[model samples]
Target: MTDLMETLIENREMVQPNHANMLESAHGGNVMKWMDEVGAMSAMRFSGETCVTARVNQMNFERPISVGDTAYITAYVYDAGESSVRVRLVTEREDLRTREREKTTESYFVYVAIDENNDPTSVPELTVSTDEGDRLRKKALDGERD
Candidate 1:
């Protein structure tokens, strides 16, 4: 069994003009690329194998991340199956001056562990052992309900 906390991944990207659109906000595709990268890292951490994105479900962009802001992406494995890992990915926009943060994008991603031969591989069971792990799991579940 693998603890959920062990698969947690937090990453950050500085949104520059290159990542922004005409509106001076980060492009959705760039945000999704960052999310997918972080989510795959979490799945690989849990499975001990290279993971491939199988699906991205119900991506919600609550707000825009403006250029010069920090994009904070967090991902954790809250659930898993024989070969699939279910990860929750969230992106927050942070103001460098005020140090304030607000959620900008949220999504659930499914990844499949793969063998060297590119075949689906089994993964260890997922468990939420720590209080923080439980809290993250609960947050993912609750977010799904909304």
Candidate 2:
């Protein structure tokens, strides 16, 4: 079983106009999609089963991400119950030229493991074995802002 401290998932996507909304910034839908994708990876890593979205606790857009920037997403398992996994998602926008990055969004997404029949399945208890894991867990529990 992968403990919370040992679990890490990350992926990156380049922002394009198709990913942007009318405001010329990354669309909220696109952000949510990336969040779900990364969160599912974390949940699957911890649960060892396919995971489905149960709820999105909160989403905060800290800054705007424009087209041509790279959106870097990172997720990690923080807390878990019998079948649900709590994951934290952080998204950053990096300038393609200078490579300067800014935090574009952050959120906590909950996912539940599912069996072959698509029913909720059990997951291993998450273990926070390091200071970083503990801190991230605390940040998630701290609510919308930290």
Candidate 3:
């Protein structure tokens, strides 16, 4: 079993010129790529095997991260199946100077664990051992209900 909290991952990236669009905000593609990478990491942590993204559910970019701001991305395994894990991913825009942060994106990513032969493999059951883990799982479920 894998504790849901143990699989939680957080990453931060500075929005630079190369990562921004013409409007000087972080590009949607760049954000998605980062989310995918972090989501995969969370899934792998939960599954204890290599994982590949199978689906991305309802990615919403609520706001843009302007250049010079920090993109804080968080991912956690909220659910699991025989071979698949569901990860909740969220991104926030943080101002380095003011330390203000605002939610900028949210999404759910599904990943399937794979063995050395690249075949789908079973994953350990997800366990929620902490209040924070329960809260995260509930939030992910609530978002799915919406």
Query: Which candidate tops lDDT?
Result: 3
User: Ten consecutive residues with minimal summed lDDT in candidate 1?
Assistant: 137-146
Name the better of 1 and 2 by lDDT: 1
Candidate 3: C-alpha RMSD after superposition: 0.6
| Residue-by-residue lDDT tens digits, candidate 3, 102-143 | 999999999999999999999999999999899999999999
lDDT of 1 by residue, 16-99 (tens): 999999999999999999999999999999999999999998899999999999999999999999999999999999998998
True-vs-predicted CA distance for residue 26, candidate 2, Å:
1.1
Candidate 2 lDDT over residue span 1-146, tens digit each: 56776668878889899999998988988988988998898899889999999999879998888888888898988788889988889999988689788888988888999999999999987777778878877877775455
> Residue 69, candidate 2: how far off, in angstroms?
0.5
* Candidate 2 clashing pairs, residues 3+ apart or interchain: none
- Report the candidate with higher TM-score, 1 versus 3: 3
Model 1 regions more than 4 Å off: none
lDDT of 1: 0.95
Per TM-score, what order, best first? Answer: 3, 1, 2
